[model samples]
Target: MTLILAHRGYSAEYPENTMLAFREAAKAGADGLELDVQMTKDGELVVIHDEKVDRTTDGTGFVKDYQLKDLLKLDARFKFASLPNREPIPLLKEVLEWLAGTDLICNIELKNTLFMYEGMEEKVIEMVREFRLTDRIIISSFNHYSIVKSYMLAPEIEIAPLLSDGLYMPWIYAQSIRAKGFHPHWRAAQDEIVISSLDSGVEVRPYTVNKDNELERFFRVNCSAVITDDPVNARLIREKTKQA
Candidate 1:
């Protein structure tokens, strides 16, 4: 079956990258959940989508500048301009614990900037091992060192390289890092690129592909998965496509 990975846990319905959101996505029958992680000032792995907390939380500061205690104090709201009571930022451990027995797979995207977290890669892998979720998790990152170090730390865990702007020949980079998959932007999902990744035997799952035509193109080329904001609509599309 074509995999329907929920982007930030059905972000269209709830706050992105929250435990509540992930739980809802699993309940909605999403095959997988994609989440982003960044290290707090105290060197703890926290689930969040942005580099700064100002956009999603009531607090105003870079995540790396605040300790985990401070981050927990802030309200991780949805639609910051509208509903400020949605949810709070969830720790990566919280997610691993919640997904212990569930069938949902995880795609962990590490948000590493220049400031660098001390042993961040090892810390994430240790959590995955403690939870015995190495096989169920796929680590990804825009930072090559983070993902590459993850591979060095735990070679058994699957890794995907997220390609966004101006990344031509991503398959070569993926191969260099021994990545199992390639996650490119929706606009970068060309047939040739898809075919090339397939030829290289790497899974090519594009992000935030919500358009009908884009979804159709994904299915037409048999891409590995589609990370989308609308799990309900994607699930319906998957079901109808199967019936067809």
Candidate 2:
């Protein structure tokens, strides 16, 4: 059965990457959570999607411009007028603390491809080790080098390469890097792709799949996991389809 990982923490109902979203995602019975991580100017790891805070927060400018203390003042749910309580941007440490109490897995995406925050891999690995969540965490990144560095830092921790478009022989590419999993885009994760990844001793988990039909297709192929915005619906379909 494909594990349902909530993309940016049940983002369909709550603000993406916010603590509220993560809590809601876990409450909805998601097997795992997928989120982005970036470093603040003061060297704190924050949970957010974009390289800048302009899209999601009330603040302007890049996320790296401000210290963690100043960054906390910005409203993460500034655009969500419907959500009564505005959520503050959470630190990676805070999120890890919460996950320490739960059995749910966390896929921490290192958003360093654009900004290329130096020593981010070291910081993230340090946090994971401090929390003793080596088994529960999956470090994924579009910046393959960051994932590679993470693997070098801690071989025991799982690292997955996040590919947006179809990479040629992704399973082989993952194996070349000694990655434990391949995080592919949903459309690119066809039956053959999934099969090859699994057969090569690599796991294939596609991202951002929300529709029922697409979810059903991935589940039918028995992919390792499906990262979706609607984990509740995915969970329901998995239970219904798997039993049939």
Local distance difference test, candidate 1: 0.86
Clashing pairs in 2: none
Where does the lowest 10-residue lDDT sum fall in candidate 1? 77-86
lDDT of 2 by residue, 82-159 (tens): 788878999999999999999999999999988989889999999999999999999999999989999999999999
Tens-digit per-residue lDDT, 110-180, candidate 1? 88765577788899999999999999999988787778888988999999888886467778878888998
Clashes of 2: 0
| Clash count, candidate 1 | 0
Best by lDDT: 2
TM per prediction: 0.93, 0.97
Candidate 2 Cα deviation (angstroms), residue 83: 2.2
